[model samples]
Target: MDGQYSHDSRKNILEWSLPVIDEKNKSGSLEFSIDGKPNDFFPVHVSFVSKRNFCDIQVAKVTYIEGGSPVRFSSETSFVVDKYEIL
Candidate 1:
């Protein structure tokens, strides 16, 4: 995880979240493309270790370029959610 939000960091980084269900889809990962940039991409990993491990999730999707702003783009492809753990 990235460091706790500093005052300046909050102004640049954007975060998104989705609920993960244990019985439905407990653990998995998603690959996403940002602003249609090939070089700029990342993965979101999700897992359920234990009840004690329950936590909120925040996904950083984009960042401001050197002298430009980050824009939202269509995903080049899609990911299937198939991994899950039964409670």
Candidate 2:
């Protein structure tokens, strides 16, 4: 899954979730990209691994560039799973 949002600030929040049945291991990646000319700003990236049903949240900050203004861009990822019991 993927998504994107625009804000006039240098920081943004992201929320996501994942579920596992009887305890399972899974891995995924979340990526953020800024639409603008390359400057002295550092690129932002992250990775994670987890188990069971849980909610994941993170805050993404836009890189500050000299004489640059915040602009619209695409960036976000998430997932969900259903847990069930069997006897």
Candidate 3:
């Protein structure tokens, strides 16, 4: 499967989950904008080094961004979680 890495400055919630083995073996983090403000849940910023395919990525814990902004990867256009290895 093709992998995509990008850097995005979107303020949203990231949902990290296990990779899906089916359907081209594609996977990625679920990024969404915060609908409401002053919420209890805090958005987690993920960063890691990957060597295998995008589907093999290991989703790390939520890291609060210094600027409180979400940045995409640096591979393709979109981010693939199926091959990402959380470091």
Runs off by more than 4 Å, candidate 1: 1-14, 27-36, 42-87
Candidate 2: residue pairs that collide:
none
lDDT of 2 at 41: 38
Q: List where candidate 3 sits over 4 angstroms from the true fold.
A: 1-23, 28-38, 52-87
Model 3 lDDT, residue 32, Cα: 45
**Which portions of model 2 miss their true places by more than 4 Å?**
1-11, 21-24, 35-87
Find the 10 residues in a row with the least total lDDT in model 1: 1-10
On the 0 to 100 scale, the lDDT of residue 50 in model 3 is: 37
For 16-48, candidate 3 gives per-residue lDDT tens digits of 444344576644444445456644454445554
Q: What TM-scores do the predictions have?
A: 0.22, 0.21, 0.20
Q: Compare candidates 1 and 3 on TM-score and give the better one.
A: 1
* TM-score between candidate 2 and the true structure: 0.21
Candidate 3 or 2, higher TM-score = 2
List the global CA lDDT of all models.
0.42, 0.43, 0.46
**Clashing residue pairs found in predicted model 1:** none
Backbone clashes for every candidate come to 0, 0, 24
